[model samples]
Target chain A: MTGPDSSRIYTAALLIIGDEILSGRTQDANLAYLAKWLGVQGIRLKEVRVVSDDMAAIGDAVNALRTSYDYLFTTGGIGPTHDDITVDAIAAALGVPVIVHPDAQAILAGYYGDKLTDARLRMARTPQGASLIENPRTKAPGIRVGNIFIMAGVPAITQGMLAALDGVLPGGAPVLSRTIAAWTQESTVAATLGAVEKAHDGVQIGSYPFWRDGRTGANFVIRATDPAMLATVASALMAALQAIGIDPVDGEL
Target chain B: MTGPDSSRIYTAALLIIGDEILSGRTQDANLAYLAKWLGVQGIRLKEVRVVSDDMAAIGDAVNALRTSYDYLFTTGGIGPTHDDITVDAIAAALGVPVIVHPDAQAILAGYYGDKLTDARLRMARTPQGASLIENPRTKAPGIRVGNIFIMAGVPAITQGMLAALDGVLPGGAPVLSRTIAAWTQESTVAATLGAVEKAHDGVQIGSYPFWRDGRTGANFVIRATDPAMLATVASALMAALQAIGIDPVDGEL
Candidate 1:
């Protein structure tokens, strides 16, 4: 466990479903949260797709993302609307039957009591053999089969469920980061940024363009799996910005 | 002149490129904002994907979403950085080569005046036969080729470009929504929500779970294309929620 190359980066992909998402009625919040969280875990979110609610489209997408990445997470279309077809589509993608599990029904029943019915039970119907994700938001319970975790579309709900999944999921190296917003143009520190990049190929350096109150600036973010490497890169960044007479917000934050 | 058979729904797909988005360094703010905006425009954001800085991955994603959805929008990886490769990928997907567009170059040339260099000139690189979308965020412009609209990944920049594109985009109908949240459990409104769903088949009516500060509630969101229909469904929702002893937000906000 105490090896030199202890940082192992796991990979993930997201499959966003729902015609509402594709039709531009809804913006996705889960993609960013999932990507960021995974990154910090030394798990890379390699790809993401927003697709329609059509079963065939959803099926094809689920099949593709599931195969491509080590873990595949999906959001949207798990709602109680007529257009909520993610469950059927996912099951179809796996060529499995969409059936209600005792555990899932129990999860819903604990909240709904006797009010749970045929349509309400539809939420409990996941692909056979898939485990249920406890949806604290609705008690509808998302499903996970193989490497795929089907989650809610709502930002708060999806993120909450993902947080719960963290305990059970085995993650890669925990990713730590330090970002400094510099009051300098990117071009001014471009050479120094290039130097840091060339020196530490494993560490990723990104410069973001920012404008506030008619003033333009750049946010330099340095990320890596190694804590010491991050410190070295960050020191270089601060030195570069200072050398160019540009101040940067310092410290571990 | 309104026809009963007119299709009221529209759809869009999003592809996010850049190792940053994939690695979770940035939470994608565009997908949510774009979703809410498109919802107002009667378009649903159905599918979305995030890919690494890899050109092959980006190119494959571009071709896939572009072929499947009515419109495809991409954010990130269009910058002047070395990792910025969206343009090359777009060109590759379309079976074309990356070439510097004179019009785009003119925009950059005007922005920096005499400071433009070969590295900065990289921003001018665009796919053949593509129209450049006006970028209000940075000097580099986003390109639109066929159905796909390529834009920046930064929230403010992407949103600004989206606002500019809004003027010329062909929209089917504007989607209107009204939400009512109150202290009530989902079970308490399940029956009534079902009734609302049944009565307003043309509109989408669903209940979302909400919990804050030891208080629990449901957010009932009603969405539809027709103004008259939206009003009717909203009125019914008010009555239904109020009937369940859940107070309305003072005459439909």
Candidate 2:
């Protein structure tokens, strides 16, 4: 449990590797999923980097992020196609050679049976001395080298891999959040919100303005580790929003 | 005109500054919009970084990205709320003090008029010696310092700012793409696609796999600066798909 005097901070970084994302051909869905999942595990997602399939760019990003965070998760480029160069890129980044993991090969072989082709064999490759992250849905497993966890680009596969690794990582106290939405422009109640945040010592408030149903409003998300502090801040925020003549909704729009 | 020998690559990096995105409270719509918009202007969006509202993280990302790419575009954190710390962060990154730009102040004052409050005045602050990116829809303008373009986190405001900056930056030839979607697994025809890409000197192929209606398929996107080469690659890809007994769809599904 986190107290007022001491709190541990565990951070992670996500590196999304793909050319389709950069070209606007594919909308990325992995970052939000991974971030939310990490939050539940009591690890803060500190940063995210999206790089193309270029080997140099991938290598650079992996090297930069892996050392900086307690955990580094990467999505995409781990498929069987030609553009799937994440394993090679990560191998280069770690100054190691790409090798076929026996466990991964066994899993793929068992899944594909006699129909396993050379193209499918590509999925078994990983950086040397890496561990395999089990995929419940797909036979091809994700790779884990050092602090980096390499995952598939497909949202479903990424989710499955994340679920498999649940509770495996050491985490700190979980950060709790409560949202208060109001049908008023953020600028109109900005001063009041700022005062409420300043008055609260252990809470951080984030105001996200939105235009929904032809009306402008904002959602103030108050985050804190202490439940009592979060409750106090929530009440204070609700009062402030009401004092500004805007009815506060308990949740988001 | 882009020829085989003299094709120039103009690249950019986007810094998405917001905690909402990381917390999964907000789905980021800015990257795709900016990527597609930049493509029309013949600039490639190479990499993207999403950082929280923390000043150090924002400043570090800005400093790292601004010097590496031809241009750096940052969206989010430029609002009246307390979480909006992008301006101060950018100022710190550039080693300059945040000051109210006279022109920005004039615009905000004229827009807000008698209803202008201290919170609204915060929108006028920018780093010293930065130009303004006009936001026609909203009174508050975007900031531009050196090669960095700081725009609003809101999609509408960011779009307006990007539109106002149309044709302002120098660019190379636009990269054109033709997509051929086929109802077949990419791994089955990976070798043929790789061969076709190798035979074409100036063209590149990207395979994007999808699962639709409980069936697996992939889209082969052929990209090239030369129109002739792009057409040749697209035809070859279609023939290759047909050869593998898969019907090809002309465009994306």
Which one is best on DockQ? 2
lDDT of 2 by residue, B110-193 (tens): 998987788889999999999999998777999999999999999999999999989888778888999888887777878878
What are the per-model DockQ values? Answer: 0.36, 0.76
As a whole number from 0 to 100, the lDDT of residue B44 in candidate 2 is: 90
For model 2, what is the alpha-carbon lDDT of residue B103? 98
- Give me the displacement of residue B226 in model 2, in angstroms: 1.0
TM-score of chain A of 1: 0.89
RMSD of 2: 2.7
**Regions more than 4 Å wrong, model 1:** A1-8, A17-29, A51-54, A76-84, A107-123, A134-140, A153-160, A235-253, B1-10, B36-44, B136-138, B178-184, B187-202, B212-216, B231-253
Candidate 1 docking class: acceptable
TM-score of each: 0.82, 0.94
Q: What is the interface RMSD of candidate 1, in Å?
A: 3.7
